[model samples]
Target chain A: MELIAERGYRRTSLAAVAERAGLTQQGLLHHFPTKELLLVAVLEARDRWDLASSAASAAGSWRTGTLAQLVDYNATRPGIVQTYTVLSADSVTEDHPARAFFESRFRAVREAMAAVLRAEFGETLPGGLTPERAAPLLVAVMDGLQLQWLLDPQDVDMPAAFRDFVALLGRGGD
Target chain B: MELIAERGYRRTSLAAVAERAGLTQQGLLHHFPTKELLLVAVLEARDRWDLASSAASAAGSWRTGTLAQLVDYNATRPGIVQTYTVLSADSVTEDHPARAFFESRFRAVREAMAAVLRAEFGETLPGGLTPERAAPLLVAVMDGLQLQWLLDPQDVDMPAAFRDFVALLGRGGD
Candidate 1:
């Protein structure tokens, strides 16, 4: 699947997608009636792969190290990362189809991350933040780093920067 | 003027701009031959507003508190924040007109942030990160937080979280 979503969804047609996939347009529509549906399917497919890994790590309890590992994994797959980076930003637009998906996803992600923080640090983390408070910021650091890395891969060492952030998190808050 | 950029750039027409601005289409086109020029004009116009403030703070030496203040300013202007949030993400696409603008902007931003860190922490920061290493991550956190805030303003307290991050920066490395 060409998940590189630099091309906004509006510009991509079902016929183009069908032609690209070597499927009849009707066949493609039978499965996904709209371009937005196809986009979400692709997003979900990507998330499934990610969720599987996160599930594996859940048994061990998600740690800063696990997040750092995920960052390392992302650095290896620019196409996947770019697809997400572009789409998430696109979702912010008014009436974007992906908005609901992202909203629910972010809520779940923050909750999952909060659970991870709680498992690791009980209630308050080392820097004196509750899990609820730190979860969004942790997610933000990852999302923000991906944007920078996608834009300038040579200058931004995403994995290294994430490691640094994890270390900073370990330090007690002033 | 309509910085609420849920409407992607391509969909926004020159006629619409001219109509909205109470200018003739010919007059508007005379000033900006292409829509990209107008987009950049809006971006630069916004930057000019922001630059005036950052310039004031530069004399006092850019500090964490100054950044926190900027976040507070962004909180008041959702339209302005949404415009930047949408455009920066959109710029990641193939052949996006805003791509060059963002690339150059990011470089300058990182350099400016590095200078700020160097001023605050000399060679290295509290967590043993060099000003150069931390600059991009700092940028990432802010950008990332903005995405989360735009998506869920009711849930995310951008300014407080930034203050917390500033506190993290003040702590020594583990």
Candidate 2:
């Protein structure tokens, strides 16, 4: 994660990842035969942090505080966050190794986000938007803020911006 | 522009770009002494389209229709859109060639967006959020949607999603 965070996926080598992991190349190959497989593992490991937060939401704790906490946690771990941000955007390219991984992950993410939103706001959110429609925009804002914050951390304030967006989402019915 | 659009900055070579433009390496080098200089030129060239739209906003014509039209136009030009999406995200890495370019561009883009939003909605928008606070979110949504759309063009309708967001932006006043 650190290697890819600094150099990006295209420049990072498998041998380097293995060295960082304290495993021989052959040993690494035994568990994951290809670089794409390694990339998926790295992504899943990173996403596990978010999935745990979502699970907390499912258990009724992932509100504004939890969301803000997640953002703050991410801010402290710039290396992991940077790896995820750079790779996800890079996945947009044709023939990128992580393209399919991100595509399916996004499909599931949008669905999960919609489900959570539906639970919170009923079938439709405030301002007459169905949870389905609002889910992608929510996802977009989070992803988008990450890009800006990563580029200009001093000005972006990822946590505060997200809180404001959530406030916006919950507005308009009053 | 087309070269970097297809291969990304690191993967693209100066020689290939020169060949594509019917210029000798010497001629290209005279114009842009380094690859990073060429990259800035390509990025600036691409940004001219957006700058023109922002200019229109300054002239009082860049509202929902123009915003949607810009997204629709970008949808038709995947190569150029892909170049911007990939490179901008890639710029977050340490010592990346386009880091300064994107950092400053985002500052300017955010400031410009804030000015336009303030003009349309006043100092504080309907939800009691300031235009300065709202501008980064708007930029994030646009950029974030582009990333998702490029990855899964069939599943994600970039322009339509942006249109939904614009409508959402206008909704709270009612």
Say which candidate scores most in TM-score.
1
Where is model 1 chain A poorest over a 10-residue stretch in terms of lDDT? A1-10
Summed backbone clashes in each candidate are 0, 0
Taking all chains together, the TM-score of candidate 2 against the true structure is: 0.87
Q: How close is candidate 1 to the true structure, as a TM-score?
A: 0.88
* lDDT digits (tens) for residues B1-174 of candidate 1: 562344454457789889888999999999998776787778788777776768656575777677888999988876657667777876766677888898888899899888877777678676689888888878888998888888888888999988877766765432
Task: State the displacement of the C-alpha of residue B65, model 2, in Å, after optimal TM-score superposition.
Answer: 3.7
Which whole-number lDDT from 0 to 100 does residue A29 have in model 1? 96
List model 1 lDDT by residue over A1-174, tens digit each.
452443443356788789888999999999998776787788789777776768656576777777788889889887667767777876776788888888888888899888877776677665688889888878998998888887788888899998887776665432
Across all models, the iRMS values in order are 2.7, 2.4
Report how far residue A138 has shifted in candidate 1, in Å. 1.0
Residues A62-158, model 2: lDDT tens digits: 5545666778888776666777787787777667878889999999988877876766667766657888888888889888999999999999999
Off by over 4 Å in 2: A1-16, A30-37, A53-65, A172-174, B2-13, B33-37, B53-61, B172-174
